[model samples]
Target chain A: MKARIRITLKNGVLDPQGKAIQNALGSLGFAGVSDVRQGKYIEIDLAATDEAAARAEVDRMCRELLANTVIEDYAFELAKP
Target chain B: MKTSVIVFPGTNRERDVADVLAAVTGSPAQIVWHGDSEVPQSDLIVLPGGFSFGDYLRCGAMAAHSPIMRDVVAKAKAGVPVLGICNGFQILCETGLLPGILQRNASLKFICKDVWLKVENTQTQYTRRYNQGEVARMICAHGDGNYFADPSTLDRLEGDGRVVFRYCDPKGNVTAEANANGAQRNIAGIADPTGRILGMMPHPENAAEPMLGSVDGRKLFESLLAA
Candidate 1:
């Protein structure tokens, strides 16, 4: 099984890095860019065969270490062969 | 008074803090490694500033989960004074000892300079030596010091008077221009309800000596020692 996670800053959180990227894009002639928010994508491979167990553990990982819930939100999906 | 300083990988300010701690306590401060599982009983536990874990996966994220933090968290809950400076502040937030997160500076650049801070709360274990509204000069060197919390949390911190320090002008005015990092409410430091855990972005240890520029930072250590 594999877990694909996407972590991002929560709505209304100020993201200076993302804002700088947006401004740079605007300066590079990329118009109509109203906003830019940055995030992280992580892919993990699990040896566990049970899909439910894998998901539950991944969720714990996100909450415990992967994502700081104070200012970030995280979502993930599991893929099993 | 005894003090223990935790050193994580890439931690660079532990010695500076130790210098101040040893001087104030009249004993050598213990150096605890991040991999250690136990924290010795002490009057104070310090998490000094540094680029912990190279700021990978967000500042202090990895360091917050190090083996030693488990014990550090337990001691903090038991009412030991834990001071987190700069990178230590980020780790405290990540560990949920302190509310909120430290994001990149508003300018998206590393900031290194002296800033005036108004003593917002003088009743805590960390700032009792200073008079209320006293302006202290401290060194702040980091790229991610912009503090952020939800609106309700901000209100609660304000209502509870947990804000220990705020960036201010020389005359003690907290103007927007005085906010160097765009921290919410210009917060430079805060304390938990028990007033034992304190996390601040400025480097007080660096300013502990007059030769190093300013002596305003030593008062914080003195306060901790007396408490």
Candidate 2:
């Protein structure tokens, strides 16, 4: 099984890196960019054969380590091979 | 007094903190590596500054889950005095020992300079040596030191007097211009609800020596020794 996770700063959280990218895009003549929010994408391969078990395991991984619930939100999908 | 300084990969400030601790406590601190499962008994447990785990996957994220942190977290919950400085502060937050997160600097730059921090709370073991409202000069060198927390949590910290340090001017004024990293409430440091755990972004260990430009931070060590 494989887990694909996406993590991002929670709403109302300031993201200076994302803001810098937006400003750079404007300077490069890319207009109408009102906002830019940065996030992370992670993939984890697992040997578990059970779909439900992989989902639960990956969910725990996200909550425990992959995402800090304090300022970031995370979501993930599991696919069985 | 005895201290234990946790050493993680990419941790560059262990010696700086250890030297200060020894100077104050009159005993050398035990250095514990990240892969170890237990931390030796000590009066104080310190997580010094540096780019732990190279600050990858967010600052302190990798270091927080190390084998030794399990014991560190257990010790902190047991009411041990835990001090996290700079990158160490980020680790405490990641470990859920402290609240809030350190975002990138508002200016999107690594700020390496001296800043004034007012001692907002002196009731803890960490700040007993300083008088209330006293401002001390410390160094902050990091790309991400902007502190953030939800409004309710911020209000609670303020209400309970857990905010130990705040960025301020030389005259002890906490104005927006004095906030170099745009931390919420200009909070440079905070203690846990129990006041046993303290996490701060400023490098007090670096400022402990006279040759480092300011000895204002020695008070923290003095406070600990007296506690």
Candidate 3:
């Protein structure tokens, strides 16, 4: 089984890196890009046979290590082989 | 008073903190490695600044899960005085020992300079040596010193008087222009509700000597010694 996780800064938290990228895009002749938000995507392979169990495990990982709940939010999807 | 400085891999300010501790208390401070499960008995436990875990994953994320941090967390819960500076402050927040997460600086730069800090609360053990509203010049050097917390948490920290230091100008006005890293409310440092755990983005140890350009940082160590 494989799990993919996406971590992102919370709505109200400032994302300076994303803003920098937005500015760079504007200067490079890319228009109509109103805003940009940066985030992280992580994929992990697990040995669990049960998709439900793997999803639960990955969910725990997201809460514990993959994301800092204070400033970032995380979600995961488990795929079956 | 005895002090123990926890040395995590890549930590470079343990010696600086130990040196200042010894100078202020007339006693040698112990150096404890991150892998050690037990923290040697001491009056104070310090998490010194440096690029712990090479700043991978996040500034102190890996270090916060190290073996010794378990013991440090236990001791902090037992009312030990734990001081976290710069990278140490990041680790403390990572461990949930303190509120707020330090993100990249608003300018996204590694800032290193002496900035004025206003002592917001003098009642805590860490700031007792300075008068309320006193301003001290302290060195802040970090790429991720911008502090962020939820609105409710910010309100609670302020209502409980846990905010210890706020970045300000020479005359002690906390203006947005004076905020070094865009911290909320210009917070430079904060203490836990019990007032024993303190985490700050500034490096007080680096500014403890007069030759270093300012001795205002020495009073923080003196306050701890007196406590």
Candidate 4:
């Protein structure tokens, strides 16, 4: 099974990379770009028995390594293809 | 004093810190590799500055998960004195061993220059060498040195006097220019509750040797020795 973990800066936290992208778009003739925020998308292969277990493990992984709970939020999903 | 400097692949200032440690402690500081799962027994642990793990994902993010960091964290929790320089400061935050994060400079540029810092609280083990309210010249080089934490956290830090250093002008005025990275509350350095672990954006090691420019940084190392 494969799972994807999405991590984002917590609400109200400044996102410099996202702001830079927004600025870049505005300069490239793209108009009315209200805002942009950059985040991470990580995919991992796992052998969990079910979706619930996979998600639980991914959450653990995020807390342990992928996401910094102090400043960032993370969620993961297990999907079969 | 037994001293050890952990050397991650991208750590550029391990030698500089080692030299300072040797000069001040009268004993050579061991250079520990990042791959090592255990930290050597030492009275002090120095996490020197560099773009650890190339600052991948986020500055200090990857290195925080490095094998050596686990050992470092364990030792820190056990009351061993740990000092983190610029990049090391980032790692400390990422590891959740310290509060707050190092955000990018408000000016959106990497700053490399001498900076003046006011000794906020001299009671901590890290700043005991400096007179309370005295100012010292130090070097800061980082793109993401702006420190940010929630309001409550900031209040607790201030209330507890854990804030040990702040940016200041040569005249010792806390001004915007002296705040090289525009950190929240002008904070430059902080200590753990026990004051055993210190994370600061300024690189004292860089200024420890007079030939490098200023020897003002020696006071910090001296403080650690006295501790």
Candidate 5:
């Protein structure tokens, strides 16, 4: 099985990089760009037997290494090959 | 008193901190490599600042997983004094020894210069030499020094007085002007709930000698040595 994890800075947390990009886009003549929030997409391959097991393993990976729970939020789902 | 400074690849300030430990405390600190699993038995363990592992993935992320950190974490949990500065502070966060995360500066630029920090709580073993509210001059050099924590965690830290230091002006006033990194509530340093482990983004070791322009940072060592 394969899993895709999306890690994002939690809401209400300041995202400096995203803010910078938003500002740059505004200065470059791109109007209507209200905001830019950045997040990471990570994919992992696993040999889990079922979707439930794959989801659990992916959550473990996020908690252990992929996401810092203090300021970041993460969610994942197992995808069919 | 014996001391040891953890040395990781790409740590630019290990020697600087070691020099301060030697000159101010009159005790030469050993340089412990990151590859070593065991830290030498010593009175103090310092995780000095620098772009450890070139700040790859995250600041201090790789170094936090270094072999010696397990020993450092063990000793810290056992009540030994451990000081983490700059990238060291980031390592502590990664190791779960500290409560907050270091984010990029609000200005989106690397800040390098002398900054003032006020001692917010002095009841810890690491800060007994200074009175609460005394402002000390230290230097901060990093791209990621802004500290962030969830509101509940911040409230807990504030309620327990774990916040040990705040950025300040030279005259001892806490002001936004002195907050180079825009840390929440201007926090510059914090202690573990037990107060034995300290992680701060400021570089006190850099200012520990008069030749380096200030000796204000030496008080931290003096306090620990006396204790």
Candidate 6:
């Protein structure tokens, strides 16, 4: 099975990198971009045969290592074997 | 007054901390490797500044799960005096020993300069040498030193007087302009609920010698000896 995770700063948390990117885009003539929030995407290949088991393992990884629950939120999806 | 400084793979400040500890305590400080499962018995445990594990996967996150941190966490919970400076502070937060997360500076730039810090609580063992509200000049060098916590946690930390240091002006005014990293409440340092563990972004060791520009940082080490 394969799993994909997305991590992002929680709402109300300041994203300075995202703001900087937005400014750069505006300067490059990319108008109509109201806001830009940066995040991380991670893909993992797992040996688990069951989709449910893979999802559970990935979720645990997110909580323990991949994402810092204090300032970021994480979600994952498991793909079929 | 023996002290132990944990040395992570990429940590470069252990010698600085050890030098200051020996100078102040009149005893040689031990350097404990991150892979060690046990920390030698000591009066103080210090996590000095520097990029641990190359600041990969967020600052201090990789080092927080190292073998030695398990022992450090246990000792901290048992009321041992644990001091985390700069990168060390980030590790403490990653290990859940401290309350908030350090975010990137608001200006989106790495800040390396001297800043004034107001001692908010002098009752803790770490701040005993300074009078309440006294100001200390220290050096801060970090790209992500902005501290953040939820509203409730911030309130509790303030209510319990756990905020040990706040970024301030030379005259001790905590104005927004004085905040170098956009930390919530201008908090530069904080102690655990028990007051035995402290995590601060400033580099006190760098300012301990007069030749280094300021000796204000020596008071913190002196306080440990007094305690």
The deviation in Å at residue B34 for candidate 5 is 1.7
Once fitted onto the true fold, the runs of candidate 3 whose alpha carbons sit more than 4 angstroms away are none
**Candidate 3 CA-lDDT value:** 0.93
lDDT of 4 at B159: 95
- Residue pairs with colliding backbones in model 4 are none
User: Which segments of model 1 are wrong by more than 4 Å?
Assistant: none
Docking level of model 6: high
lDDT, each prediction = 0.94, 0.93, 0.93, 0.89, 0.89, 0.93
lDDT of 1 by residue, B112-183 (tens): 999999999998898989999999999999999999999999999999999999999989999999998999
Candidates 4 and 6 compared by DockQ, better number:
6
What DockQ does each listed candidate score?
0.86, 0.82, 0.81, 0.49, 0.72, 0.83
Chain A TM per prediction? 0.96, 0.95, 0.95, 0.91, 0.92, 0.95
Top DockQ prediction, candidate number: 1
How far is A54's C-alpha from truth in model 6 (Å)?
1.9
Query: What's the ranking of the predictions by DockQ, best on top?
Result: 1, 6, 2, 3, 5, 4
Error of 6 at A48 (Å): 1.5
State which candidate, 4 or 5, has the greater DockQ. 5
Q: Output the lDDT of residue A70, model 2.
A: 84
State each candidate's clash count. 0, 0, 0, 0, 0, 0
Best by the lDDT measure? 1
Q: For model 3, what is the alpha-carbon lDDT of residue B199? A: 98
Worst ten-residue run, lDDT, model 4 chain B?
B176-185
Model 2 per-residue lDDT tens digits across residues B135-220: 99999998889999999999999999999999999999999999979999999999998788999999999899999999999999
Estimate, for each residue in B71-123, the C-alpha lDDT of model 4 and write its tens digit: 99999999999999999999998888889889888778899999998998888
User: Taking the tens digit of each residue's C-alpha lDDT, what string does model 3 give over B1-227?
Assistant: 88999999999999988999999999999999999999999889999999999998789999999999999999999998999999999999999999889999999889998899999899888888999899999999999999999889999999999999999998999999999999999998999998889999999999899899989998999998666
True contacts kept of each: 0.87, 0.80, 0.67, 0.27, 0.67, 0.73
lDDT of 5 by residue, B1-227 (tens): 88999999989888888887887678789999999999989888999999999997678888988889999999999877899999999999999999889998999899989999899999887789998899899888999999999889999999999999999899888888988799998999999988888999988888887788887788887888776
Per-residue lDDT value at B76 in model 2: 92
lDDT of 6 by residue, A1-81 (tens): 788889999999989999999999999999999999999999999999987777788889888788999889998888876
